[model samples]
Target: MTGWRIRDYHADDVDGILRLWEQMLAVNADPVYGLSDVLASCAKDHAVVAVVGDEVVGAAIGRAAHAQGWVVFLATAAHVNGTSIGSSMLAALESRMAAVGISKLSALMPAAAQARVGAFLQQGFALKQDLHYFERHIPVQREELKILAELGGRVLPRGLWDGVGGMNAEKDLLERRVVMPLAQSELADRFGVVPPRAIVLFGPPGTGKTTFAKAIASRLEWSFVEVFPSRLASHPGGLAGALRESFTRISELEHAVVFIDEVEEIASHRQGEPPSPTQGVTNELLKIIPAFREQPGRLLVCATNFIRALDAAFLRHGRFDYVIPIGLPDEQARWAIWERYIPDAAVDIDVRLLVEMTEGFSPADIEYAARKASQSALENAVSSGAEDPEGPFIEDYVAAISATRATVSAEVAKEFREDIETVGRL
Candidate 1:
């Protein structure tokens, strides 16, 4: 308690610092800054130690950025005069850092270290009340940035899931089956629930399959990379080789949602005596899936308008966790779609009537019709030399509905229902 001296840290003080750090951890379950960070700062930043005859008893570490200074670590052995020792070490650290024009000194002491508060308060440090610490851990790390750029992938912004309008049924299914497990992976593992690594989104053309894929990525805050089969066709290694290379690069990413739209083109049934032209590409993809599943923190979303045309082996249980149906929008879904396209200025528009007329319309069909209605109305307004600030009227919408052809036929809708019953896993 009596023979303690405080001075600037030296290279030999590392062992003394380690001893104090381990002693603090033995008592407190949590320490804000990691041992590595504290040790690194001790070597490169401002630091001081209190020793009893060359045996270290206390230490204070700090760093300054701009005018603000942070007390990264403060600790003293139990046998020493802790409060007096801590205050002395802190004062020494402040003096060492004072040369850099530091205006304010702060300590991020965790709740477990409340006993050490006396040292800070005694050094004229005020305890901040009603203040919360907020931090966002970025999903992509620095090393993965180059790989993501090469793959033309990016982390999508938030709110896309809500912006999807309706399709609540599809959204609900994906949220529970795909998103919940992956987002809460630890909890899922506790319950022995394995998150889906890959899934097939199947439906008739223009049912927003691609939209759902991107929204899933956005919802999970993972990087999105869409692999285009047509683009890969021109690769010098050929489509199969290009497909293999793309996935190999994808493996380097820590977290990603890889999308392949119109997958039927590359994954069609491999049959016939001479073997189909895309058979090699299909074989390459089949091999890729098993390897992709082995790696964690990745999801493969393959969308196909013609699910029936896909190879039977590709849809097996181990390869894809779910085979979901993204069919035409139902009543509620159609209403949401109309709501999305309707301009805020078009207050007089009849949404109910428009929804009724757009039944059996694919989401793409609804969007196309809405755009056409606005265009026709614009032409009418301009040609007549009159301005209608209220955008398109209900009549304009009705006319557009009549003119627009549904992307999905009645027959296609019936088949999709049948496919869901037979092939759907969810």
Candidate 2:
């Protein structure tokens, strides 16, 4: 017998799953789902398929709402019908649903389908003859998301923002300017408040501008669509057309937070004798921004390390709602970053001393020093053959701090301060 394995469904499995669904219906089972419905369910919901080599031998599809879960489709190949495939597939689907906080799982099938109903019974599903299954279908917007995915856009997990350690001011600004307006759209509209459509996050390198943009998406519970200039450069219409098409598809989503990092690559100032090559792309972006702003339920976040390099018109009043700066971490932020990097141990390490010593370090710089300290401690422990090695000592951290270089130089920091004073719009 060929070895079989269960795994998450992929786009490639669509054909196999369709064939499997056809085979099940051929056996006089109820035919309620269309091909598009099945494909959409597989795309946006939790689905698993059992495969022997590349051939799908069994499958289960599920979705969760509130505290209830529904197994929309389940099937096994005729060759493997009597084997444990059916029960195993159900178990896998239930496990996935349970992970997402679904406590009740129910299935619907016609009374004549004994074999299909038996599979559910074997997997602990009770027969509810007293109850009836009724569903009012909602139109699936998954097709729009499918197009977005093909354009390299994705819906990121909400947990990402929680991982951002510090920069409380940046976080607060994002919440008030972006998250609050969108999340409380009805409330804000009632008070005659208009939600911002575009914002710019400007700062020195390694200050977590991109991180804040992603966190805003997470906080708003919206889909994230990052337009990659390099990826779009290969399109037939070139970079400018690719960007326009990407935004066109992105507008299909009900709610989205679009991001363009290192935006100065295309939006830089057009001054100089020969004129810049990116001037056309800059003009295209400016045109796209106004149209994007006219639409509700979307926000554009652009991040740049050198805000001064951008074209002056790009940062003008109507183009962006806010131009916020994300500077180097303060003492409290540094302490948070330090404490996060240190592992839990029986012995306490002096993190305040480490924080004080690395006053000029960015979050990334501090993380590097912490990793270096842990690495050196581990190497020493292994070399010395210490059985009960204690945690990284303060001295270990001190040595790492002395050796580690800060990413932000004093000169660059001074320049950043000047830029904030002169050009900052927050």
Candidate 3:
């Protein structure tokens, strides 16, 4: 058995801690705060370390100010894995903070650090739900950004920006319906039941499936992993490798959200047709699902445009636990969608008329209309050489509204609604 001891940070242990921090950053690529900064912060008596036979096995450094505490660094030596030393060190730190009348604590961690973050949460840290750290490096020259853009990678825009729109409702639903229930249910203690059940969100394209996935991940404080189906099938038996990697990475994440957009291409069930040699992909994925279920803090979400085309096997219990039908927005949801996209421009616009006209419109359709309107207004202003122009005029919105027809025709919507009703009755 490995022995463990917790002690104050010491000058002698600086080198070992530095090595541990370097190893952590190497594996995670998190920006370094430098050894001098860490030492200066530790001098305030907020640093603690776990030593296993003269080697620093685990450590946590934090600072307290104005009754709030922040955890700046936490790491465990890679060689001393699975000792629960990291968890113990966190507990000790929490206890120490409590002694000083500090109860609230926060930390910034990479998405890959889910397991370690989970250890902290288990020790009674209340996660701040919203707020994610998204960073992209800036090249030395603007030309580099242009080159990156040409290669189809996005260059970070100057300054930090939150994604457009709000997630309050989504956050509330995730916390109340998913996170809190899972936390209090029997799943809380049973690793086999703790991992989020595989769920399928199927609906019209651009209906916010991807956004909903990210919001859920954020609300639950789960690391989100987005997988591209095209890359999953690049090799012979490559699908298996890809699926395994996704599950393995999520397992390591310890409360991760694995979202597969356009999932029908991968997990779709095949029946009555000749077996595909690539059938190994489905088999491999099926096997991994159970393994993920056995691990705590893993969530697998699949979104698709066609639900009926999917294999019945995938819909069976223990595979995809829920098949959520994300249909086109209802009248109320359409109004909300319009309000979200055209916040300022909607001041004088008849939102009720817009919603009524867009009876069959999906969330994506509404957003598209708003954006098209905005673009049209910008172009008109530039062409006219106006002294001043407002963003997205009502007339422009009306013009954009007239340009496109509803994606979900009335006949199609009726058929879908009836089919769902029939299924629910069954």
Higher-TM-score candidate among 1 and 3? Answer: 1
Give candidate 3's whole-model lDDT.
0.63
- Cα lDDT listed for each candidate: 0.87, 0.79, 0.63
Candidates' TM-scores? 0.70, 0.69, 0.59
Please tell me which model should have the higher lDDT, number 1 or number 2.
1
Task: Report the number of clashing residue pairs per model.
Answer: 0, 0, 2
User: Candidate 2: misplaced stretches above 4 Å?
Assistant: 1-141, 273-275
Off by over 4 Å in 3: 1-176, 183-196, 272-274, 343-347, 422-426
Model 3 vs. true fold: TM: 0.59
Deviation from truth (RMSD, Å), model 1: 16.4
Candidate 3 local Cα displacement, residue 364, angstroms: 1.1
Q: Which ten residues in a row have the lowest lDDT in candidate 3?
A: 132-141
Better model by TM-score, 1 or 2? 1
Residue pairs with backbone atoms closer than 3 Å in model 3 (clashes) = 255-297, 269-311
Question: lDDT tens digits, residues 29-128, model 1?
Answer: 4888999999989889989889889898999998887767788889999898788888888767776665575656777777778668888766656677
